[model samples]
Target: MTAAAPRPLPEWTASAVSPLDAKLGLELLEVSPERAVGRAPVAGNTQPFGLWHGGASCVLAESLGSLAAHAHALTLDLVAVGVDLNATHHRSAREGWVTGTATALRLGRTLASYEVVLTGDDGQRLCTARLTCSLVPPRR
Candidate 1:
């Protein structure tokens, strides 16, 4: 049998808020089960050295990955909670926005994983990250 096409993500307003995301000035461009895209401005997210903070990159990566995983879980009548996240900083972003794209690596009944790549405006990789989430029944 042919593999089934992936289901389209449900309609969701782009108003999901996280205090850390807001503090870092992250803007969500798209959110879906297949992928999640967002950008964080460097102005407010920089470290004392004037470079983008590695922690900020991790926050962006986790935000995208978790959002995508959660979206995927919704299709199965489940909820997702991030169980693990990690990031390796490849380079520093001194100016402009850093864009993050989270692509699903695996989507299953009880688990989901995504790889998130953060890049500078010039399209150079700044960080690589992975996030795994546990899918579970929604709490009553």
Candidate 2:
């Protein structure tokens, strides 16, 4: 992650979860220093109703925000935990991978906030999510 670039949240880390848990195959492709950008296939992320699930969006949002917060605490040796999150479904995603961009709204010493927008293959908004993370202090 470049200092000038945005950062990725902690939950985006490969170490945080197993491949099986990445049902949507959300790949954390870019961490610009304070933002997390990723992509996940619609097929795996969608629900039985054939649209992307709201919970899936929330998972992505929380992951991105948490990862960014964790990165922020690296200097002090800590992690991050999701405290609050909200997701608004704008449209359904049915046939392709969706791009998600997580932008940090706040990155404080004890807490962090991020807004994640998931766009369909055609670049239409599928969901808008916001998340907060509480920095976990290191164990002494």
Give the per-residue lDDT digits (tens) of candidate 2, residues 1-140.
64674444345365864353377586787653377788777776767898788787777777666666677667556777788888888888778887888898888878878888989889988888888888887767
lDDT (Cα, 0-100) at 52 in candidate 1: 96
- Which candidate leads in TM-score? 1
Could you estimate the TM-score for every candidate? Answer: 0.89, 0.82
**Clashing pairs for predicted structure model 1, backbone only:** none
Model 1 misplaced stretches (Cα beyond 4 Å): 1-15
Candidate 1 worst ten-residue window by lDDT: 6-15
Q: How accurate is candidate 1 locally (lDDT)?
A: 0.89
Count of backbone collisions in candidate 1: 0
Every candidate's lDDT = 0.89, 0.75
RMSD of each: 4.9, 4.2
